[model samples]
Target chain A: MLRFANPTLFLKLVRWLLPLAGGAGAVLLAWGLYLVFAVSPEDYQQGATVRIMYIHVPAAWLALSCYSLMALSSIGSLVWKHPLADVSAKALAPIGAAFTFLCLVTGALWGKPMWGTWWVWDARLTSVLVLFLVYCGIMALWTAFDDPARAARPVAILTLFGFINVPIVKFSVDWWNTLHQPASVFRMGGPSIDPSMLTPLFVMASGATALMLALHLAGMRTEIMRRRVRTLSQQLARQDGGS
Target chain B: MMDTPHAGYILASYLLAGVIVAGLVLLAVLDDRAQRKALARLEAQGLRRRSSGQTGEQ
Candidate 1:
């Protein structure tokens, strides 16, 4: 991680990893889908509807985890002045927003059949909705400012401050009175969900994480290039401008 | 299982995955090309400035 503080090394590392991550993400997702549909047994009660969890739950996990990653990177940016950390967090917002949106959409689909409602204000659901909005606010703040450095301060503060919500989202179903179901995968004793259902869920979650990594890397690369071009253009403008 | 009849959920999940993943891959490819092109332009511009500077000295 420290080695990447040097831009030259970081660029080289990203160059090699991007293609590998993209290829691996594609292959893993294909295999994961096969396992989700063909191999995993259908739920006795929910039937094929349970299959939504394969996508929904994984996205929900990533949506939460990505924000944490962003916050942690922001802290590194502030404390250690780690080069590219802020840029990394800034790049992650849109990807996390998409995952959060996916989670909500799939959750609603699952809810319509399972809970008899498309949009319940369940504690878990509402908290996650807020988390998604927070992601949007962070992205907007970063782009709103004319100066990138000025933008980083407030955006980093907000990203770090919002770290409080990650645990709340994880425990909202259990902590408050809500219609949403409690933790099944991360409970202390064991996962309450049966193995038939759990296997596909794990496979899909793994695939989703890989996909997010690929997306995050690709987005960060674009951001890096954009910054470089902006710098060059600014220099060119200064040289050509009249005295 | 048979009585529930929930193929719609499965279809939706597959469709969403296909759309999102394909869209991301397309963006990555296009962004990579755009970045490379911009970099090339900057490099050419830099070289042009240096050549002009050298000719002015001569």
Candidate 2:
């Protein structure tokens, strides 16, 4: 992993990995969508509305996972001073924010049909909202400084601080009385859902994970190039000043 | 797939997710391309990046 701290090595790795990740994501998502819309039987209670689970659950899961990745990268940046760690953290912020936004929107869509309201101020929903706001704040903090290098420490510290929200978001329903349902798929007894439903959920989740991986590589590639551009321009400025 | 009692909500959720995910992918691709292009342009201007191991032909 530390060997990948070299930008050239990282770039070479991503060049091939991006296409592989993208292709796998496409195939899995296609298969997952087919299973979701065509094969999985409707819930007797929720009917067709339950199909929304395919998108909502994966979005929510990925949202949390992305934040976890960012926090880990933050630690890497602060402790190891890993070259690419800050780039990874910076790159993940918007992707995580986007996923968090999707989770909220899809949850609202699911909530309206099943719970008779678009939203409720319950522990689960409220904590996820807080997580989303933290995502936004983190992103804002990334650009809050002119020098990206100077921005790194604050961003890392804030990310570490903000990580408290992740567990809160995950266990809120279980810990408190809420309109949201308790964990069905990841509880102590294991997933209580039918195999048919569980299969598509995993497939869709794999696809989403692959997609995030592809985007993450692309984002890091962009950052590396952007850093090069900044360096080159700064060198040119210094040369001009000296001349 | 669109004839159910709450099909609209389900469809909307999927559609929104699709749009957001696609938009993110598109943005990442475009940003990568733009940066590469800028770097190439800088190289073309005889400005070689130090330590990138590129021999820039002026």
| lDDT per model vs. reference | 0.79, 0.89
The alpha-carbon deviation from the true structure for residue A171 of candidate 2, after best TM-score superposition, in angstroms, is 0.7
Give model 1's TM-score versus the native structure: 0.91
Which ten-residue region of model 2 chain A has the weakest summed lDDT?
A1-10
Candidate 2 per-residue lDDT, tens place, B9-57, comes to: 9888888988998899889978877887877776777787768675321
The CAPRI classification for model 1 reads as acceptable
lDDT (tens digit, per residue) of candidate 1 on A152-227: 7788899989888899999898889898888889999999998878877877787778778878887777777666
Model 1 chain B worst lDDT run, 10 consecutive residues? B49-58
Off by over 4 Å in 2: B55-58
Model 2, A59-177: lDDT tens digits are: 89999999999999999999998889999999999999999999999999999989999999999999999999999999999889877888999999999999999999999998899
TM-score of B-chain for each predicted structure, in order: 0.66, 0.78
Q: Any residue pairs clashing in model 2, and if so which?
A: none
- The residue pairs that clash in candidate 1, if any, are none
